[model samples]
Target: MISIEIPRPSRRIRHIHIEFGTLTLDYQAGAEQAQNVADQLAQGFPELMVTIDDDVRADLPPLPCAALWD
Candidate 1:
């Protein structure tokens, strides 16, 4: 799985939004892995918005046995 970490603005703002571009992962891993990653991120940035994208293409598969968040 490929992961991208984006830092939120420090200054207080009326609205906070987070956009995760796109994601594709092994079907075998299931949604649990995705949720785990999202959960971990949430713990670090409680106030920051979190978005998870799991629509990955099977045709363009990722590297074999890739590590999460690597």
Candidate 2:
């Protein structure tokens, strides 16, 4: 089983928002803030796998929608 490690809050983190369905994690932080958080997490759990994916609304790809009934 692949265990997901979630590090506790530190002085660097400002906000953490989580959503249920997709298990979306939203961190209100920039590159520096994120780096600090990752560094903290790495100290205790060195084996943990951490992935960061930054999303910009403007760069999002358009999805195909269903055609309207005639």
Candidate 3:
């Protein structure tokens, strides 16, 4: 049988968004604090250069986000 796989983003919740142009991380926190999750990812993965966007970009073409989950 052939196996198919779906790629998912590494996020604690569905509200978080990550774009692969330069590892942009975004999260929908409370009204006062909007970038709580994005800050966490940046600190946790210091080896990689990542950016945080306040809003999601809906105009990008669909493509492979990651080669490996880990």
Candidate 4:
């Protein structure tokens, strides 16, 4: 996981960005799984921006990329 901390204007924590590495499932199939992961994380850590780094999108041949941020 990649952790990024950003500062807010109100002197509070802005948002936390968590990046998960290349997931080895079909892009479409893995989306639901990814959402569930994000939801679970949100339950414990509210209002974070969860991101996945599924390298497949970058590896795919010339087409619009898939959405990995939820």
Candidate 5:
């Protein structure tokens, strides 16, 4: 199995909105917020799929995964 590690959010994250199907999760958080969310959703990974909206950052080069961002 391939592992996907999400970068923990920092203070500047300010806001994050996530929606899937008819379910919507909207929140504002600080460091480690993403980790907490991931832990909550960890149980369903086998059946989960995601659609991401991307805005390329000029400051960083394209990486196979963004896990290193933090």
Candidate 6:
């Protein structure tokens, strides 16, 4: 029951796609809002390991992604 945030760049690179596990939030809302959502998830799902992606670009090695989900 762990949650994750994946910041994916849009096709035009105009926005940062914010995804929480299978859920997606408003990309234009910025990190604070995203973090708030993450906090909420953490509080709601107390039994799950919670994590939020730190805006790591997709081009990086898979390590960061792995760390997030794992």
Listed in order, each prediction's TM-score against the native is 0.33, 0.36, 0.28, 0.32, 0.33, 0.32
Which lDDT value does model 5 have at 52?
A: 27
- Candidates 2 and 6 compared: the better one by TM-score is 2
Where does model 3 exceed 4 Å of error? 1-34, 54-56, 60-70
Q: After superposition, how far is residue 69 of candidate 6 from its true place, in Å?
A: 21
| Candidate 1 lDDT, 9-62, residue by residue in tens | 562111112434453233322344445545775998575555444445545343
Q: What is the lDDT of candidate 1?
A: 0.44
Which regions in candidate 2 have their CA more than 4 angstroms from the true location?
1-24, 56-70
Report, for every candidate in turn, its global Cα lDDT versus the true structure.
0.44, 0.44, 0.43, 0.43, 0.41, 0.44
Task: Choose 1 or 3, whichever is better by lDDT.
Answer: 1
- Give one digit per residue, the lDDT tens place, for model 3 in 1-70: 9998989755521234566656665544332232444465477865644444444444533222321221
- Candidate 1, residue 11: how far the Cα is off, in Å: 41
Clash-forming residue pairs, model 4: none
lDDT by residue for model 5 (16-69), tens: 334566875444443245444444455565343322223323443322232433
lDDT of each residue in 1-70, candidate 4, tens digit only: 9999997555111122344455222332244445555577678866554754444443333211323332
Better of 5 and 6 by lDDT: 6
Clashing residue pairs found in predicted model 6 = none
Clashing pairs in 1: 24-56
Candidate 2 residue lDDT tens string, 1-70: 9999999765322332334455645554444555555565567666554444454244333221201100
Clashes of each: 1, 0, 0, 0, 0, 0
* Model 4 segments more than 4 A misplaced: 1-29, 52-70
- Per-residue error for 12 in candidate 2, Å, reads 15
> What residue runs in model 1 are displaced by over 4 Å at the alpha carbon?
1-29, 47-49, 59-70
The residue pairs in collision within model 5 are none
